[model samples]
Target chain A: MQLRQLSLRPFRNFARIDLEFAEGGAVIVGANGRGKSNILEAICYQSIGKSIRGARDHEAVPHGEGHFDIRGDWQQGQRRHPCRVFYGADDGKRVFLDEAPLPRVSDLVSHFQTVYFAPQDVALVLQFSAQRRRLLDIVLSQADAVYLKALQTYQRLLTQRNHFLRSLGHRGVDPTEREVWDAQLAKPGALLRHHRLLGLVEIMPDFARQYDVFSTGQETAGLLYADEVIESNPDEIPTRDQLEATFRQQLRDGFEKERHAGHTLNGPHRDGFVFTIDGEAADAFGSQGQQKSVLLSWKMAELRLLERRKGQQPLLLLDDVFSELDPIRSAHLIEMVEDFDQVILTAPRQPQESLGDRYARIDLE
Target chain B: MGPEPLEDLVVAFTRLPGIGRKTAQRLALYVLKSPPQEAESLAAAVRAARENIGHCTRCFHLTERGQELCHICRDPRRDTGMICVVEEASDALALERSELMRGTYHVLGGALSPLDGVGPEDLRIAELVERVREEGIREVILAHNASAEGEATAEYIHQRLDGMTQVSRLARGLPAGSDLDLADRTTLAHALQGRVQF
Candidate 1:
């Protein structure tokens, strides 16, 4: 699948812009804060119904505009499917696939697959555990609906459990109801962690391989899932039942701590991955180059994992990431990126390694 | 925004499921623009339905004229041994409209949603249990929805009727006329998992 064209209206810095792509993909070139990344955001947002930069729909709208519109025409050989997304400040978001309303965000994910890469994605590995979990989830959710449903179920139950906890502190409530919520939460929560573990297992080699390709260091690369529920070997994926039992015990044990905090604490939401370089935590010990390599390799693994799982090459969106890469890594990235079916690169100046006819350059003014 | 009666009508429309403020406003305006007889008849229909339509004592289906039992329950040809339980009256109505299921119906009123403080006692679950135990039900098809709450409610009901009668859930898979390639991942997974031997 290929994104044939992208049109953005009243979205962020772009007042109204439309660009028709040359076959493979296009390089959106412009200076900082010039709406180059916004174009990439629009494309990724339409496919995923989310902001890669964590901006809300209201914030994505232009200063004077109350809403934003993004439409991308996709072509798979002879078939042309137009995907459109609309976001209103007051009305929420809506997506249309070939002019039919898609009611669910998860349903929209695989319609146009994208892997968004930027400098701060290191934070995905080095900082917040949620971002690391999201790294695994975003890929898995797009490929398998079962995983997505399980994730949604787990999130809803977590919200309910947390709400119960918050209420438990202020007023007297039924302890029996907590059992029901916990029972429901355990099943899906275990499934989520199990999938994340399986996701790591499946992509660990690809992650290491990509790291070797991108990194200058000679130390061994590793991605370990630091689960709070169960002690899982970094190499082995635990079964759902095993994780479920542990999750239930942890939730039960957390009752006292959770009561005082007024929020449920131990679950997949608190889980994170620790990226390692030669048995050392990358975030704490690795150099700047190693950290950037960790993020790049992880994202690259994501692309490969999605392709292997879904049997379709996902579109790669490079959002001002080339600026952060060294000359060798940038060259390596451009080479590997060319192999993807589609890649939309956002950069201040055109990279030295150019795709002659395979790329179209758009300058955001 | 409108006069007292018009605003009241719109607000009334808004109280119904899926009817938003804008739709309610449009409906109210449509009623206002129509002939006086049309508005009067609409009001009469709502008032009459609310006053007359009540849950049947036997099947829990909505019955008009304050009937003791719904028409399906009163029908002698319908099977008495099989009871298909649903979460809402509308679900039973849908099954009846489909012209499937010769069995009687029992509306649980709503599923067991613990988050909302609803449990077995909140629904007509105990009544359902009693009916199955005393009525000598051979099989109880649990036709509850596939949501989390629905699953829990079905499980709860299943445990109650486990030894008393054979309880089964509704079949889930792809809808008819959907191609395998075009079907969503979830539906396709369900269809494949529940596939019959060819």
Candidate 2:
């Protein structure tokens, strides 16, 4: 996909602005708190149908402003299209794709594919399990819609199951109904676990290969998924039926514990992955430098995997993450990004040394 | 996007179900270009209908004037022993348009959805139970949408009225004009489960 222009009205601190980027992508340069990231955020919001910063519409709209509107002209292959997003206090949020109203915001999510390497993503290695799950979810959701749909269904089923369990203490509900819900949840939950494992399997090799080369072959890296649900073997990728059976068994086994806990005690929601460096858990002792190399390798692998799966290169948004990188890694990052269709990088200071004319400068004032 | 009056009309139209801003604008402009008398008649009709119409005492469908019951509830020809429960008045109207169902109706305000914070109390389940007990309705057909919440609502209603009345849900299968190949797996599965002998 190609983003030709971004128009923002009363969004965040930028009262109004329209930005057009070169095909090679642009560099947004400004001091801190000058709404530089806001430009990239507006683009990302249009792309993903939500704030990448996880902000609510009311919180994102400018103070005292009744509304905010963002519009974009984009091209996917040879097709040129326009999208508009409008949010107001009275009317609420609305989205249009190619002048046609989108039934749901989710309709636009599949249309706009972007790989965001925000500064915070670098800390994913050291962050909580929720953060790591989010990273995996974003990649997988963009790669395939089925995965996203299954993930959403699993989440809803989890909530409904929890609600049913909570009602058990008060109501004389049939145990059959609880079993039915458990059976329903197991399929999607198992599918999610399966897909996430597949996603990691696809990205791990590239991560390992990249890390070894990028770190000058000093340490070995592996991305291992820990199956908290049923404690299934990490190496085996179970078929949907197998996963469903396993999930059901776990649900049955944990029924007593879950009844006491007032929530589900086992499922993909509790499952998380860990990074390994030289046969040791990265979460506990990996140095910052090791974390950065792993993060870099993982992101690069994600970019390649997305391109391979989607059959189109996704736009890369680096939000000031390129700062403070050593010369070799910076050069490597620049080289890797040049392969993307478009790359938008935001930084407090302009990139120096060998950035060349490939990146257009958008000096935010 | 338009002049203040036009925008206001558009916004008002958009408040209606399934009407987006663009469609609302088109409808507003159509009204504007239409004959002045026609527009007045439209507004007057809407106002008069809203003023006179209230919910039916039993079914909660639309009623006119100071009538105590809707036409359907007042009619002696319709079967009062069985009530077709639907999610909305529009659904009840659709059933009436089909001319297939001879029974009266019950309209739940909406389906049960915990995610949306709609519970059993938020719906017309209590009214439905009262009607079933007082009217001695024999069967309750759950003619609701085939969504998760809709199914849950039907199940809850079933549980509430268990042994008091017979409960049946609307049949699920391929649509009237769709091909068998076009039917989804769930639909086919349902059709097979509910299949009848030739």
Every candidate's lDDT: 0.81, 0.80
Question: Please, what are the lDDT tens digits per residue for candidate 1 over residues A1-365?
Answer: 78888888878888888899877888888888787877888888876778877767788888878999999998876899999889897788888899999877667876678888887557555666666667777778776668888988887777767766776654665455566667788999998887887777777888888998998867778876773222224545668998999998998898989978877788888876788888777888888888888888888989888888878888888877767888889888888876788888888987776556677888877
Q: Can you tell me the CAPRI class of model 2? A: incorrect
Q: Please state how well chain A of candidate 1 matches the true chain A, as a TM-score.
A: 0.93
Error of 1 at A277 (Å): 2.5
lDDT of 2 by residue, B44-126 (tens): 99999889999987899888878879999999999999999999999999999999898999989898664565557678989
TM-score of 2: 0.74
Candidate 2 C-alpha RMSD relative to the actual structure: 6.9
| Alpha-carbon lDDT of model 1 | 0.81
Query: Least accurate stretch of 10 residues (summed lDDT) in model 1 chain A?
Result: A227-236
lDDT of 1 by residue, B141-160 (tens): 99989787787678777766
